[model samples]
Target: MNAYGINPDPSEITEITPAVDGVESIPLPLYGYNVSAGFPSPADDFIEEYLDLNQLLVKHREATFFVRVSGCSMTGAGIYSGDILIVDRSLDPAHGKIVIAVVSGELTVKRLVMRNGRAILRSENPNYPDIPAGDELRVWGVVTSVIHKV
Candidate 1:
């Protein structure tokens, strides 16, 4: 998709990369309290626990994979180009979930919407058209997390 969040070019393709196993865990200090965003508040100095990102995000280790988004089809969902999406094959393709799917042999990241026994891939951007699932549609996984560089 372009900057306007419309007009998805067929040539643009999202790439999927399997999550690597056996990487050493690096635990980071995690504060116990939630920080206030709208007002200034007293901050906690003591660390409550150590947090491992992989442990927090990945529910099923062996069934997870990473996919790099290549377009703005999902911009409305806060997903953008170059963002890494964590997808889990073990999760059910429930309605309203963003998913990594293979449509006509191409990998795509879109929301799955089930209606009256039919399923369609819905783009987050309104300008894009919804893709009705057919024989070629294959749900690869349900997108669990999106890692973005701030």
Candidate 2:
């Protein structure tokens, strides 16, 4: 199981297809994340209250994929370099879905916006520019969830 509550076994996912063009394959982190070896001190209740043993387990029938993030363009959205993004292709892609897209031969992760017959990829940070998607743009998958460290 992953941090975003997904099982990574191939047999578990009902949706499977061949890889698309220009899509760099990324590995999903199926196991849980661990930063240190020892248990957290009693003073910190975040782990105890939220991540108890009972909650750490997951059923194997759910659909989930993991993709490692690159670049800081999504920093404003809380997704940093090396963070694992949980992508649920089973979910429908709607407006405002943080999607992994292939635009003009590049892989980009951004918020999906559609208006006036144009699909725009909006960045969470103002420093980055918005990208317009035409017929050549491909919406790879919708990012259902994100997993990152504090």
Candidate 3:
């Protein structure tokens, strides 16, 4: 379910490369819209200044892989459907961290909750059931950031 009530197609999850050196191109949503509908162009100087890479704080080289969310189960945690999640596979998944996991061949994103000797995958939305570690589950990666459209 789309938490924002927008059902954009899956093909819209294409990547946009950042204008930075040595940064592997990761997927980003196409931001420009209504351009053909007579959107006025910004001043040349302003556009150039805004597009300059050196002015940005977060460099593109820091991002690894990005995945698009598709359900409302994570909406309470501010990760709504269609949000792009930046994943760093190099980072270790720890308790209480939001992570993407694969269980029984299905991919899911949830918070890791360890209690006693079992593991529980807790959802941000209480409507969804908690996932118990009865199936073959593997930690895919920890989520670093959730990129959303304004």
Candidate 4:
């Protein structure tokens, strides 16, 4: 069993290195007014300031990385198959926090749970079971934010 508490399915996971090559920080104009999703409101033409996503999303540049999710195991936690997750290695993997972990060399994303003083990686979906994190489990990073297009 892997981090999902079931036999590891090779097709259900994929690991990709964060794309930082030739990527430069660009500051975009941030508006002051908050857009309403419930109904359309009059446009407020106010420029707050220049906002850089790198500075906002990433806390520690060296310890932070991005991962593309590839499975529905974390759907219950609002993470979809194509979501981009911002993971920070410097943060502590506390209980109930979603994390990207490598179990026996296999990479998987799940919530960290404590059971009987032992760490167990649990899936957000009820279809999956909780996998006991033994000595071989290595936490890659803690998920700080998830981004997906509406």
Give all TM-scores, in the order shown.
Answer: 0.84, 0.58, 0.61, 0.83
Off by over 4 Å in 1: 1-13, 37-44
- Model 1 quality (TM-score): 0.84
- Candidate 1 lDDT, tens digit per residue, 6-122? 454342346767777897888987876767665334355656888999898888888998878887788899988888899999998999999887876678888999999999889
Candidate of highest lDDT: 1
The sequence of per-residue lDDT tens digits that candidate 3 reaches over residues 29-122 is 3334446766555544323222322323233345446778787788788988788777666678888998877766556788888989777777
- C-alpha-based local distance difference test score of model 1: 0.80
Candidate 3 runs further than 4 Å off:
1-21, 24-63
Query: Which runs of model 4 end up more than 4 angstroms from their true locations?
Result: 1-5, 9-13, 19-22, 38-44
Better of 1 and 4 by TM-score: 1
Report how far residue 132 has shifted in candidate 4, in Å.
Answer: 1.3
Instruction: Give one digit per residue, the lDDT tens place, for model 2 in 12-130.
Output: 21233332334443433232335487744444333323342212321111444567776677778887777776665556767888887766555568889888867887778676667
After aligning candidate 1 to the native by TM-score, how far in Å is the CA of 120 from where it should be? 0.7
Error of 2 at 63 (Å): 5.3
Best by TM-score: 1
> Which lDDT value does model 2 have at 45?
33
RMSD of each: 4.6, 13.0, 9.6, 3.0
Off by over 4 Å in 2: 1-63
lDDT of 1 at 63: 92
Cα deviation of 69 in candidate 1 (Å)?
Answer: 0.4
Which of candidates 3 and 4 is the stronger one according to lDDT?
A: 4
